[model samples]
Target: MNRPAARLLTFQLPLAAFLVFLLFPFYWMLVTALKPNRDLYNLTVNPLWTWTPTLDHVRRLLWDTHFLPWMRNTLVISVGATALSLAASLLAAYAIGRLRFRGSGVLGITIFLTYLVPPVILFIPLSRIVSALGLWDRPAALVLTYPTFLVPFCVWLLLGYFRTLPRELEDCARVDGASRFQVMRYVTFPLALPGILSCLIFAFTLSWNEYLYALVFLSSTDQKTVPVGLATELVTGDVFQWGPLMAGALLGSVPVAVAYSFFVEHYVAALTGALKE
Candidate 1:
């Protein structure tokens, strides 16, 4: 017992240090967001607090700018992408997980590898296509293009989660007069819900935080997502409006952060080396 206790004591310090290092930037962002624009001119390495904290940055960003439209655009795009990705991934995962078909294994790999393809490789061509389709600079462009990235990853994730589920459960559902679709809807989906939902959150955040595609495919101020709008509108040439920028950063992160806070433990468990639960 003392040996295990001693090992834990030795490990705890380094682990705690690593956690502080990981979380420091977020803490810094929060601190900077609350600091008055006047004090931002001065250098402060301390993240704990400064001489004083204020809400003027957050207030002005909310009341004085077009941040509300940016936020709305982000919400609409991310939610639409999440829904489309989830629906598409469910069908694709079900096909690969439960059905036997020619070239299924090869197709699965192709789908996952598609996720690894960088946006940089496709953005130039995608922009041309969006322009050709009359979606360039349109919010509708995001409602379509974000899915290309979202579906592949979500399908891959859901496939793995569905694979881990007991085949017996699905088989039982089928024998109980359920069709293939019904089995997935009732048996597999419910059992795989945690990991599936985790991937859904990932897809939503990916679309929400995405910048390069939004910057390329959208140029209109009213159509910009938070990531692009905040960068373009808030910061003029060579001028960093630190206060409002920080405020926008904080607000942009809140939804994903809140979602992560709620589901992080579940996500950790699901992806952990342990598979039992």
Candidate 2:
């Protein structure tokens, strides 16, 4: 084979296959959501494509179910968790990365190690904490608990990014009679915007899709997040509402997709900066 043809076979073919593999789920979800029950259940009909597409599932998900409320609860919880995690992580990362303090290196390592602890294990103790605090079945429960996992990862990422930044700029700000808070506000924080945005997106996505904690913490229909709401309400023992379930899943993923589409460049840049140190 010619060199160009070999390159196409080795690179383009694999790339195309991977793209299809990655995208096939979304395509399947869309098709399943649009398919009528008759076409959906009929083994004789093509499963990949539907002759009759209907909006009944979407309509049912929006009108018959509490999907809109679930979405609102999810949005509130995700935003709250992301904001709280980002604020705490920024302070923790900056102090560990920039300040000369005793055991700062150990502290940073310890924080990152916490991220490795399985969330499934923490959820059990967290359930007790949430109930003790009277936050169970409330969005506040998730907002507070989500930081257990989110803060550690965010701090680690921010610490690396902070290390990559030139410390001289911070020193220069301090020499100009600026306070620590002022230096952070005007100098370090501004430079660290990309990393912050990356952490925000990550935290939001995790909070949005979180299932175990959401399932355990929230029992009310109106208080549930998208993931929990869809799973519990759309499936009844042996029966699965496949159409509405797929519709919910497709809709639930849209916010995260839009978030990545908007800030993907910054996310990549942040990861690059963090990896530099």
Candidate 3:
């Protein structure tokens, strides 16, 4: 084979295998979501594909459970936490990347270090703080707690993006009598749109998919987010509601997929540019 053909042959097999491995779970979920329990368990039928598709699982998950409220709570907490994280990250990234302050390197490392700490370790102290603040069993608890990790990660991401920009732009804006905040608002932010969107997407995804914090912070049925809600409510002791569980899992992943699809180009470009710098 020619070199190009040999390279194509080399890449395609692994790519196809990787794609199948990654996508099989989603495919299984989709199939199971539409399959009746009879076909799902029947040894006679093909497990990979469903011959008879039904919306029963989807209908039951939607109407027979607290799915909508869980989705709403997840949305609210994710958006709130993303917004808060982005605001803080933008400021922190700018300061560390451009301000040239004393101990700024140490401070940035310290901030990023906080992100590395396991949530399992921090939740005990956080739970007490949440309870003391009267936020337990409420959506507000998640919105507040999510930022502890989100902001650090977002700041680290934005800091790399911020470092890639030309300092002269901010300097020129400053020379024009623009204050630091004014320069950030009028100059830096517009140029860093891709990075900002990337941070927003990351922070939102983290908040939306978080399970431990949601489980620990929220106790009420109405307050639980999608991940916690589906796992806890769909499984009754030893019995698992496989149909509705698969249905809920499929539905729960839709928002993050849509969000990623919308921002994927910008996110890719941001990472590329940051890496190039």
Candidate 4:
């Protein structure tokens, strides 16, 4: 074969394999969600492509359970946590990245190091704090606890983005009688839109998918987030409700997928630390 043809085959083969590996779980979930219980268990039929498709699982998931309430609870917690983390991270990033204070380097490293601390270690202490605040078994517990991990990563990410921006811009604004707060509001934030959106996506996705904290803090079935709700409610000791479980998994992922699709450009820009003007 020609060298160009061989090179094309080499790259395309790996690319196709990677795509299949990444997407096969989603395909499995879709098929499992649509398969009837009998078909789901039947050894005679192929499990990958069900001949008898049914919406019974989806119907039962919606009508018989508190799926909608779980969705609402997740939405509220994720949004609240994201907003709180972003606001705090934005201010903290500006101070660390631009303020040029003594020990600022150590402070920045310290903040990033907090993000590296495993959640498993933090959750025990956080659970006690949540209970002490009378937020046990409440969505408020998650909204507050999520930011403990989220804020550090966001502050670190936004600090990098802020560093790429020129400090002279803020100086120019301050020269025109703009207060520090006003400069941040009108100048820094507008330029950091990509980083802000990236942080929002990260924080929201983290909070939405969080299971350990939700499982520990929230006891009521109605207050559970989708991840915790699906895992706890869909399994009865040894018996797993595979159909409804897959259905919940499929539906639970749609919102985050749509969000990433919409803001993917900005997300990429943030990761690359690139900004226009």
lDDT of 4 at 274: 31
User: Residue 10 of model 2: what lDDT?
Assistant: 99
Query: What TM-score should be assigned to candidate 1?
Result: 0.88
List model 2 lDDT by residue over 1-277, tens digit each.
9999999999999999999999999999999999999998889977999878999999999999999999999999999999999999999999999895999989988998898898888888999999999998989999998998999989988987887789999899999999999999999999988788899998998889899999999999898999999999888898878999999999999999999889988777766765664
Candidate 4 residue pairs that clash: none
Worst 10 residues of 4 by lDDT: 268-277
Tens digits of per-residue lDDT for model 3 on 1-277? 8998887789987899999999999999999999999998789988888878999999999999999999999999999988888888888889898888999999998998898898999899999999999988988898888999999888888888888789999999999999989999999999988888898888888899999999998998988999999999889998778999999999999999888899888768766764554
lDDT values of the candidates?
Answer: 0.83, 0.92, 0.89, 0.88
Count of clashes, each model: 0, 0, 0, 0
lDDT tens digits, residue span 1-277, model 4: 9988897799878899999999999999999999999888899888889777899999999998888899999999999999998888888888888887999889988988898888899788888899999999988898888988999989888888897789899999999999999999999999888778899897888888898999999998898999999988888798888888899999999988888899888777765663331
TM-score of structure candidate 2: 0.95
Pairs that clash in candidate 1? none
Candidate 1 runs further than 4 Å off: 1-13, 43-48, 270-277
- C-alpha RMSD for every candidate: 3.3, 1.6, 2.1, 2.5
Q: Candidate 1 residues 1-277, lDDT tens each?
A: 6977877778877788899999988777888899876677866555457678898888889888889989998998899878888888888878876785887888888988898889899999998899999987887788788888988877777777877888998888788899877876778888888878788778877888899989998887888888888889988988888878988988999988887888888667645522342
TM-score of each: 0.88, 0.95, 0.92, 0.93
Per-residue lDDT of 104 in model 2: 93
**Candidate 1, overall lDDT?**
0.83
> Which scores higher on TM-score, 2 or 4?
2
> What TM-score does candidate 4 reach?
0.93
